[model samples]
Target chain A: MRLKHLLASVAMSATVLAATGAKAVEIEYWQYVFETRVKAMDQLIQKFQAANPDIKVKQTTFPYADYQTKVAASIMAGQGPDVVQLFYGWTDNFISGKMIQPLRASAFPAADIERDFFPIVSAMKRGNDYYGLPTAVRSLALFYNKKIFKDAGLDPANPPKTLDEFVAAAEKTAKRDGGGNLTQAGVTMDMTGQDHQWWREVLIRQNGGQPYTDNDSKVAYNDEAGLKALTFYIDLQKTKKVGQVGFMDEGQAAFRGGLAAMTIDGTFRLGSFNTIKAFEWGVTELPANAKGERSNYASYFANAITTKAQGEKLAAAEKFLAYISSPEAMKVWLEVVGELPARRAAALTPENLANPIYGPFLKGLEYAHTTEFKDEMAQRQVAIDMVNRVLIGGETPKDSLAKAATAEQAILDRAAKR
Target chain B: MSATGTEAAAGGLWSRLSLSQKQVLWAWAFLAVPVLFYTVIRFWPTVQAFYLSATDWNVMRPASYVGFENYRRLWSDPLFWQVFRNTFAYLLLGTPISLLLSFVVAYYLDRVRFMHSFIRALYFLPFLTTAAAMAWVWRWFYQPVPIGVINDILATFGLPQQPFLRSTTQALPAVLAPAIWAGLGFQIIIFLAGLRAIPSTYYEAARIDGLSEGAILRKITIPLLKPTLVFLVVFSSIGFLRIFDQVYNINSNDPGGPLNSTKPLVLMIYQTAFSSYEMGYAAAQTVVLFLILLVISLVQLRIMRDR
Candidate 1:
């Protein structure tokens, strides 16, 4: 009876081993994406699973609002995912702490990937350590309502070339249907989310102001350029009334309402409004200021490997990252989801050049610059709130700038302690 | 039994140990598990929060003791004061409006309603719908544009669209209107139960005296419902004090947008902690807010006692 029981236990152990061996390897990915990118991500995951036959990808998606919290909290817990979606700004936060594992030359080699992307993509790298790879390149462009411009006796073919004209045209196009209330707005320069800081950043940058100092010593938001940008926005709300209501989200209701002639927003919002039929719209470059400088805002997501993941799992993750970032994959992503290609090679391809969806943004890219992308994650929250205070809270330019500086200093101190 | 024998029997009760006593000890052993869990999960965190408030700590770094510096910052900060003012204003407006509206509707519905339970459930719909979704729906409804419901209504009335939630002067009041709406259903049900609990003889006595319906309601019903009214006032004040999501969702971190008009204290606390990453200062703001609410509640209770 004892011999029979031992044999039965051995058989059960063998069955358990077989079950464990058949289970698929799990890979975790995190992102701040929604809609088409989310769907495309599922498709990409399915495709990779079929190709590998052993790896199973698990995705944790949050809206952009929660993504920051999730990343910081997880990283702090020392238990982040096997692979993660990173914005260029977060590179310093993770990499400088040696929290992220860097890839060697063989695992993408830098050269095989370096020549493909814009200079901004390399901004995530520090020395010889490559912390991330570009997933998508997003930049701001001027989207104009063609129908509104024609009604305002402005040439739809020729948008404003200078900041002065842009302001004048914005004011001229604004009209009151009754009782000094705006029936149609001339411009939408700001909002609360993703690109709220774009136009302001561009104008500030052009006026020889930096959101942060050159060495990142302190917030330089109170500089001349910052004041000028703030004054212009205040004038739009207070004097011109060309911008709809106060506070951009409430104010810019004119754009989506088909009343605003032009809006400076990221190219990503184009997909959200691709099927608008009430008004004919077109894209163009942001107008230059008197200093002959112009820029649209830029920000993007990247693919990064984790420190904890090992061996075959790491290899599979890298392959999946590379495949999604490939020229062909970039084409598929852009065609279906309306995302800009992270790779310059993909963006400059014949198919992409001829695509009508990308026309204005492509025109605008020559003058594009990044919004305040920070290395230390601590600075991000303060800077973001600072923008909120200025663009939404309606704090005076000086006060807002001072708040940003104070907040930024606190963040820096916290980061130093970390 | 003799008297001495009875006295000996009474003295025998003082003897230690029994089978039932041993069983009771085993039952007490069973209760220890949940008590330990409560200490760890519930009581421990409350105690830890007190200690954390005295220190300068981000999640990653070692917590440095800073004594009462956070509280000191709370005293001097204008943003903290603004949010404090906003929260108080929310309570000041929201409580009375909700209580009055709930009282009226609930009283009318209580007298005669088909499917009483169904009517109560229907009135409680706002409480049932998830807060986040309702806040989003209200966001669009409160918009100050051609698309907003109120603006469309104004257009039909031949009036210009007013800046409802975005105006400095109008934003707080306009935001309060939705909160008042959202709060009505729950308060209504509470009042309905209270009204139903009142003795019918009081109404009958009022009728015998030839009291008018309005007169009996004003004199008896309201005075009788004071306790329920107090309950709603306290709960609603707590709700309005933590006014984060509605304001946060409406403006998307532009909570006090339009010249710092709508930002509440709780929203400021959240922004300071998570957005601005000033946890120490945020904690200070929170401690101040908690004290403010506590003092107000105590004052309210004292005044209520007087009445």
Candidate 2:
């Protein structure tokens, strides 16, 4: 009876909040999502509307292919959303110590938020003035076929541990059909802005070297470490006969049709592979470097209040952020969006940490590395193009990277002026 | 009564608008919506692009006035020059080939009056499809592997499998094949229309004068189709200079990859602007590209008018 009385009082307050008015203060947020995740976002937004009766959120979404440019253009036009989503590294450009307010010190504990977020791990400059807030994080991983491993007489439970082991394993699994042409490929190392493998970047760092050194301003990875790493990648096809020449990702529909026994991709693709009913599959760590370290590449999805969003709109934006970045909102983000949670508290919950399907992701995050380029958008294009040049241009890796650095520096200098 | 009639007569100009004039006004009234729609959707963006190109902007931060510095920088960019060279190379090779192929098809189609309409529509089908969809269908077709269909058929006859798009030597030609495929049909249709409009008297006169089949074509048809040929060449040049969607989709790995073999000037500008987020540099590229395109278009127009 006493519990019923307390529930009744709470319900009355909720009702009073609801009766405040129609046309509540509406805020817009732009994010990137697709497929089942988009549906999950719709449901999550609906729930938020119900919880906060006086605040409404109008959501806009675009595919990852065009979201960055779209957001950048919108912000410049002075008509961007009240709250916007970005990649982790993009915050530096907008923050510049002006524009975008810090996380509300009164509404949320800044110390706790910083200590609990994975993005803070890689942040260089700590400050009382924060411009970026992240909601979820993830890293790339290698996927292999259990049936193929058992057929090769290797332990299905233990995949390749080192880069050499991976090469040997791949060579063993690859096969050509009756005609003297490739029918099954062991791996694909194609790099582009789209569906490009981040494994290559991480492997260089793990192979007793780093992709970026000197606070990420130098192209340190393009030297001996880069040559060793790339030679290993190229020789997989050119000499080792493990990877097929010109066998890009688009040609891998056959792989999903159960042609190859292994593939490397991001955690986001696990849901898609779940639909491949033909083959029994399992997840594992990416192959380790010669130094016996297995590291993968990671990037984050962050939200920053735009320069256009200030005053009451900025205050409202912070309140919405406080709600969205709370442990509760992040849970909805991870479970519903298929993203690994960014907050430590949200991630520590046993349901996320112990879920056998995603436990590898939690473990993989510990060894993840970021790319060496500071200006994320610039190097992302020029650097990837340099890799393609090395692969197809037949230019030595060192020359290609030096050329890319020239182009990347030009882009960085241009971006810095604004 | 006299004063009242005079007052009514004095207001005559208001009612003097005739039915024909009113009907024309009503037609313009109906067109106002479409005109407004086109102005806002098309012309507004062009104006906006021009204004935005004058600023040092990343499309993220506050835009600042940068005068003509963007244009100054583009003048010195070597990569921009390379892209321009690629675009011109594609145009020089791709345009004449389009004209000759369409002329041959148009002449043959015109010979068979019974099947002319049916064959024309049949060949025109590819032009109606979107470039993106066509590019993918062709990307697989251009695969260098012997397993690819084109190579498979070639291999069956003991011919070597050509690297249709994967090779630095072959990538540009491979990309141009689809443009030729998509473009030939339109030129063929236009040439066919021009052929139909040509009077048959000239062909009959050549035959009476003892001209051979080849002679009649050389003397009568070539002279008559000269105008259409020039127009087709100039129009196709403008279209090919802006080559992007086909090159972009043909090989997403690198449009100008295999050592910058296929990058068109316009596509590079697009990459610099949206893909790289260097709006100032992209604008400089645009202004320079605009001048090149403008010069080509003006020269073509001047020659066409003189002809």
Candidate 3:
């Protein structure tokens, strides 16, 4: 009887061992390192792992500066991550290189994804195939210092709504020393950072012009509308004397340090700006042009599956991607990272839409335009040259823009061949 | 019989060789490892780069022969010319100014007996520090009024705050300052060593002859310090010619910016290769840089030689 009991126990233990031997499939995901984003991703992965116990995710984050190099190198070495997050601008390069593969229709229904995500997510698609999907989208908004407005004798609550009011407010807020140099900037007109994005997406569209045309194969910003947009920008320095290029340490530093009154920045800065204690700040929709038509630039960070991933690995990656798009995951991402959710349903919810800080950025997304940039760096360089020629070189806006258009067209032509 | 035959052959081979031939054989035996290493690690890549420069390879795409297309494009490109001028400016200005400043400091500091090692260590501290850290610290020093130490000093003296790194005219000099400063320690240490190597008897003879301080420095001291000067000049010229870290860090916001005034050839090559993924074009630029470095070094060595 004792021998029989021992045999039965042994059989039961063997069954338990056999059950545990069925291993979980693991997939690697890569993202550029940002503290809040990394944390949110980790939390999302935890939720994913708990739900899908048979699937495991291995997450790695690289520094933003070297992220592209690392990803490209790894992909070329045939050791790429199963899932990778890329800037929307880089979609073409990765797609053309075959570093990333398009989502299969059966696995990821194109109709469903388009219905679930923001319209801008379609930028990741080439024809009928979708290359990637975004968890959040960022839109540009006007961030103004309340204290600066109050000191300038303007009402703190009433942010500028139109171009005329913007210039008027900027004039009041601008402070200069005895030497006629800016001590405190009224608004950041410098193209050191997002100024080019502002020029291309906001000003060009506002002035009834398109930045690019012919499926982004040609430059369209050399016309009267382009001239008008550039003149308006240059006039801020030459005519209004509100902001200058070298004023207050360049880019968003002046705004962050409370040395600049206003800056047109993105929703991604909300987390960083929240750390500022020196001044009270508020966000408003981007000011409309004289025609009363408003435009803002929206961009996103998208997650894609690499070409190296196939069969079970691809399936596991798709599962993770799906998890990232789910309302629950996006909610966590928005709360933790301060990015507006990419999904319409998620972003339109009462909690997110009702939040005073996030409301303006979300509202801007309704009419925001995201460019499917062919050569983002080259295009940006052309814009920089245009701004510099007009601002620093004392050239006419029309002449500078014509030169920029020629240069930009050459780049676009080269990209078209590629 | 087989063992005996093998021993006999080995002995015959050794005995037949001349002394010089044996010496050469032993020399080659010792040199073999380093020669193989250079061939694989250095020479091989350099040769491959020459081939790559003539092709269109963007890492992902299969490389196709493009003849001199990349080079041809580079010649017509205005940005390349601007970068070329910027690079040469760094070499011409950085080498001489840094050498003069370092020599002046080393010459004076050599005579001081109080806290000698400590002072030397202080000068050498920057050499020991990483270039990235030094660049960032200097970048802070070049900031506007409240943030920058240099501007704060200017303000203290009731001077107008200057946009050191922001101005196109000033940004290059601002970037070069830290680079020169970082290299001072190594140059000073080398200079001190050279000074110490000169026998005290020459200075004593000069003193007895009633030679003035400037005359002795101009004559005996400087004449004796030629080798050290030559080495430092060549090394520092190479350092300045390949300048990237300081410029990259200082103008981090828009690197080589404020109208690309601070751009060096290496930074341009880096951006082209990595940012644009134009490997073939980048390789062409690399070849140009290499040729420049080689020709300059040869010219420098020829000029500074003890003929």
Candidate 4:
């Protein structure tokens, strides 16, 4: 009788395990570990699981610095996330590496994506197949400390709108000690940071120069306009003396510490900046050229389904990707992460456009250019070296610009060959 | 019943074997684990690297034989040469300076009795700390004017502020300083152990002979510490040659940046492999580094072993 009882129980437990194994499809989602982004993803996951009871999503995060390396190593080993978050700049690399698969047109139609989302989202497109979708987008704007402006005797409400006015305000607000070292800077200059983007996308465009041509595959920034743009950037330190490089080591740090009056940063900084209660800050559109033409650089982190997902897991991943890229998820991402929604309908609402802190950045999206980078890190390093040559190496701007163009052209050529 | 049958069969075979053969079997059993481990873990990957070095394996596409192309590219690459110089700079300067500093501290600290362990712990604290954390602290120290401790001290002394990490000329040394400091603790401990192993009677005999302190250090302590010195020289030379962590972390905004002034060979290999995903090219660089390390170590051993 006891043997019969054990047999019955064992059969019952097997049935229960089989039932669960059939009912649920589990997929892993991965992203870099930014506090707000992780929190937002968790909330999204909770909502997703509740609505789709048959699917379970597991979330994994790695530090931003190590995220790419971790993703590559794990995927190469054939065990990693089904859905992974990647920088839009890395979409090409991912496609070439076979790390991710293109989204099915039935699930994500190319025409619908182009009509609904901002035009910049097309950076993820290659031959009518989209590899990824972004929940939010980021663009550059000038962040100014209102308290510093007031102390410097400039109207806090009247921020600079033109390049000449911007430089004038910077010079007026800058404070220097007896040693001629700036005690407080008018602006922060860090080539290693977003300054490279500001110079390449905004300054060069405003100066009537195209940074790249030939389908964004060739260097065209070696012209006269490029020389002018580079010179303007260098003179901010050498001639204007309004700010110094390496003054607090980082540009954002100087602005955060209230030592700099103005800094050009991206919309992603909004979440962190909102946390600081020491002083109030305001965002404004980047200063325009003499002709009132403005430019900005836009970028985003996108989510894609990796090649590892198949059959049931692939179906679940498709559902998860669609849900996250929906208007509702974009709204949640905007509220929590301070990045703009990718879709025009979701981002261009009346209330969102009128928001004082977000208005300037939202306006910047209309004219922003998304650089189609072959290798974003390598390209950024080229821009950095270009600036350093003029600033530290004491080279001429014309020479530096020519050298940079040649170097960047070589990188692009090499990438094209691959 | 089956176990007894098998045991009886094994015993019949074992009884026929000679004593030396039995001992040889035991030794083979003992050697198998480590041999298997090294084959799988160390030597296999090394051999694969040599093979992969001649192929164009970008991790995404299937590998194709590119023989000598990667080596030829590395030969003409200016950045590789710069990194080569930076790596040698770390070895030539870092090894000697770190050795001297650790020896000095260990030599003096050996005689101290008051709060000795506490002081020794303080010196060793940096070694135990993570390189990432220690590098960040040093980065902060190199910041300018109102933020940096070093610059603040410079201001007090009426000296001009130095652009330590920002300047290409100074960034290498600035990075090397913390690396040398971090290794000092371990080197000092080794030196202390070596110093303690020396007989106290030799020192007493030296005192009786009226040898000066300088003479005692030069003749007695120096000669007795030869083994320790040789080991440390080779060990630290290897350490300095492959220096990555401190340089990578300090000024992380641009690791080996400001025009690649502080970039070392290891960092270049890392970028080429991971960032650019040029696995074959990275493998070629790795083979070069392996040869360099092998040659340096062998040379060091040969020179030191003779003297």
Candidate 5:
């Protein structure tokens, strides 16, 4: 009699909940698979579910290589995830393709976003509407091995503050054998990875030049500033002989193996650096140009709602996004995933601003900007071609940059028409 | 009664048909499933790809007809020409090298009676392994000194470390080495089966006639293995022509790295379609690849066929 009464009460409550328009709704969220990121997302989902009793969040992750393709294909098939996390680099395609819907004004106001998030959020906005909000924003900083500095008779506490000093320090720390093969690289200057970031953001900007124009619909990096930047990077390999581009990971593997002294990489690398026990390393602001002006590149991945979502599903997705972007969730991401928060109230706190490992990256947020382009992959190919022409093809920087500019301009023109 | 009588007369005439006609009808019925399947799945997409080649489709908008514009772009693009050379290089170098190495291994191992099955299984092991896994292991072997096993061996011999996958001139061969190694196992297995199928009487007869071992191999063994040889050559040629996974995996950091010295045609198609979302352009490139593969295979078959 007691068991029968208990079953009857549970069934009655379920029926009443359904009748009152409180039926359970499930929303799927997708992201790229990363160790720390997966754990952090799981924690955030648990917190979100606790707040919304009638909503369920199903999280899926794809490998980094296949994430974009999977999302685009799924959307084309009309079965995409309700909410998806996309890199800011991919924002243009998703928006123009009409794969994602913009946030409703009443739910997420433009003023609130501008005041809360970093300035780089402007890249995610079109006209008067914003597309997405990041939980964390990343910036590049100088990661130097402390022991390499000490061995080279340089001060361990004080890293290079200017490009000239940085080169001098690299010369002292770089080690080559009798035959001049690079056994230990000083810094990674390969265009294969960080060299492009260092050139465009730090060198070009510090040289007092803009990297693009016309709402990022034009390629304007073929001027004097670009020439100087390319010359500076090429000198590291050809003239200064501090590094070469033929290594496994563009000297990243060498740096991690204690064979390289320094590399300019994003804060996402801090998690990987923490696992290294062979060397003592520290992070500092990227070295400035001769004028003492500094700049950095900022990138982020943000949650976006898909066009397939509607009505109840859209409401659930919006609520989930709001919870994930909250200060509480940002703090959890920072603590668990080591990605610095994008929210001003969370990131600008005294405790966060004082941390030695993360402080330099946070400082970079003041002057950093996202590199916007119409077709990022095509432009990246152009950069690679430009650098390879100078480094391996033995072509002059003047000639290569001119040709690359023409090619990039053609792509931009085509993109504009499309 | 009149309709029933007419149907019975037609049924009686059908039952009186010849045995060969019944067999032909039965064969057609059996083949219908696969024919319909291929028309729907394979042939339809191939026809679509040809039509899409002339249009401009980015998977976002409705495909618009653009005439021969995509083909014109492909003709003018320098990367397409370079990739064309790289693709042919793989087919020309990879097929013969893999075939020769497998033939040598199978020839020698056939005569060995000591743990023959075990040796054969060892030779066939790599065939069962995944291409991606094999490529990664080979990538580790091609790394710099103190990490790469090959460079480590060179160091032990007091020789200088050589950059394998990093150098442009050496990268294609370095990538090809693993591809050839992976396919060798399957080819060797097929060769062994072919060798086993040959009766020993021919060899014994050649020996009794006082012919040398070399003469017997050239005169009898080679002639008997022509069919297997032709099959393997064609199969291996197609595999080499479509080489993508090995290059893509070994050079995952940059899909076609060191200035794309090792990029095959398929990898370029993938990048053009997926990375840049130029579906029509990629389709044009795909049609070109199809033509090349078809021509190469037909030419090889014509040359290596019965004559």
Candidate 6:
């Protein structure tokens, strides 16, 4: 009787062990903390888990300032996210550093990706294999305060369409105190922000200067067109006296606070701007050059499978990536995060194209150039310093432009060598 | 039986040692944990850093030997030289100015009996506040016309508004102001303690000698406060040399910006390591910083001690 009882108990324990063995595969996901992005990702994770009950995903976040450092350190220590979110510009660094692995062709086919996603999404493609995929993309546009335009005696419905019109409107809208101090900025001028992108890809190209040449391996913005582009930017503050660099400390702050008349910003700013109840704003395409040529800068953050993902974890990560990159997921992301969807079908719908707020940004995508940055921050800093030298140091635009081109070329050369 | 036998054997060994020898053993046994900890935690990493400084490591790939290429590159890098100058400026300007201001405050506060601790606490309040928070507050204070307090005051007085953090020339000093202020409390407290330690008799003797207040301060009080002065100069010098948080938080949009005007050695090291992910180059920078700190501290000690 005792032997029989023991045998039954042993069988019960084996069944319990087997049950535990077949439990869900848990994988970790990491992203820099942006409120709407985090919320959208959380909602998607739930939807993904409900559909694929055999997999569980744990999401983690760090502040944007420390995100790169945290990822580099944690992944190097052999413990970190199975799947990670990285800026599209950092794809090369991530690929070369072995922080992320290429997607399996069977899981994510290059042909399918090329067909469905925006052509700019090709930035993530390294040779034949794709390193990652973006759920959304961003493009720059002119965000103007309708009330400010009316206050300055300009038509609210008619924002600037050309570079000359932009300057004229800015000069009219600009207000100054009795002592010559600027009371109201005609437009925001912050080089450390999106202005760097505006100057490099938009203004330079509009003026017939290619920011980079030879497949983005060399700087090519040191010519007369580049000088003209830079001079025009500096003249807004120096000759025109329509704006100041450090008026309200930041361009976005000044715009949101209603201290500035206009700002050039990206699509990612839409959600935050929508929350401001103080003013009614309008979005317009970036001002074109004399020949009616227009340009813009497009950028995005993409989700990638980290090198840490292997075997079961790798399968789980790929599934999560696929789910996040789906059309349905793009819809949810657009509703939550206010960034344009990466897939052409998801982004270019009738309702979306008709949206005045998102329409300008989408229109910008048609002529946008995605700069293949080897080091985004360093290159951005060079542009910032170039403008500051002209603005603060009283250096001529010609000298500053040459200096910037040299500095950026050195950065690219260093990265290439590495 | 074996356990008891082992215990008995250990006891026999312990009993055979002299009293001093037993005490020495006990002391070593007590020190064993910390020494082991330091070896693994501190010394090992420092030694590893030296090794890494000689190699090309970007954290992801396996490190390969690169001789002194990183060091050679750093030597030629103009940013390195500018950063070096900025660091020394922080040390020279920040150390002396803060020490003087703190000394004056502490010297006067020592004689005031009413609300003394409260006044000291008011000064100490800033020290307790986080560097990031203080930097943000100061940043707001330095803003233009309608937003910034300083500029607001200037506008009211009809004085031209100064661009504090924006101008490359003014930015370093603007960043330094809050750093000096934050450290004032601790330095004041130390000075006060040092002043008190000089004893009431010294002041009384100076008074009896018919020395003026200034004379008393110059001849007696300062001389007696020499040791305290030495400690503070060294302490604050090190503090200024390693300054990072103030400069970083002040102009966060461009942390050593407006043309890298206020970038310090530590900030440069952090950027090289984290932003650029050039571990080997960062390690070389780190070694340079370590040597600078070591040499400065040694020179200060030697000068202060000899005098």
Docking class of 6: acceptable
Candidate 4 structure quality by residue, lDDT tens digits, A313-407: 99999999999999999999998888899988999999999998778888898899999888887888898899888888999999999999999
Model 4, span B73-124: residue lDDT tens: 9999999999999999999999999999999999999999999999899999
What tens digits encode model 5's per-residue C-alpha lDDT throughout A91-115?
Answer: 7778777889999988899999999
lDDT for position B294 in model 2: 91
lDDT of 3 by residue, A262-365 (tens): 89999888878999999899999999987789998999999999998988888989999989978888899888998889989999988777787999899889
Query: On residues B152-240, what C-alpha lDDT tens digit does candidate 1 reach at each position?
Result: 67876778777666566788887777677777889988998899889999999999999999999899998898888777778887888
**Minimal lDDT window, size 10, model 3 chain B:** B1-10
- Write the residue-wise lDDT of candidate 6 on B1-307 in tens digits: 3567666879988888999999999899899999999999999999999999999898656789999999999999999999999999999999999999999999999999999999999999999999999999999999997799999999989999998998999999999999999999999999999999988998898899899999999998898888999999999998998999999999998998878999999999998887778899999999999999999989988888845
**Ten-residue region with minimum lDDT total, candidate 1 chain A:** A244-253
Residue A11 shift from truth in candidate 4, angstroms: 13
In terms of lDDT, which candidate is stronger, 2 or 3? 3
Assess each model's interface with DockQ, reporting 2 decimals per model: 0.16, 0.24, 0.22, 0.42, 0.23, 0.45
Q: For candidate 1, write residues A1-418 as lDDT tens digits.
A: 6678889999999999778756767778777777788887777787777887777788888888677667666766777677888777766656644446786578677876667776666666677767778667787767778888888898887888788888888977877655565666788644454334553457678777776664344567777777777667657756788875432244334566687887777777886667687888877667788877787766677888877567877887777777777776777777667777877877876766666558656655545655434433344445445544554567776787677678766655545454
**Predictions in order: chain A TM-score:** 0.81, 0.81, 0.93, 0.93, 0.92, 0.92
User: Candidate 5 lDDT (Cα, whole model)?
Assistant: 0.86
Best DockQ among the predictions, by candidate number? 6
| Candidate 2 chain B worst ten-residue window by lDDT | B143-152
User: Which 10 successive residues of model 2 chain A have the least lDDT summed?
Assistant: A191-200
**Model 6: DockQ score:** 0.45
Residue A5, model 3: lDDT of 87
Which TM-score values does chain B get in all models? 0.84, 0.85, 0.91, 0.94, 0.91, 0.95
Candidate number with the higher DockQ (2 or 6):
6
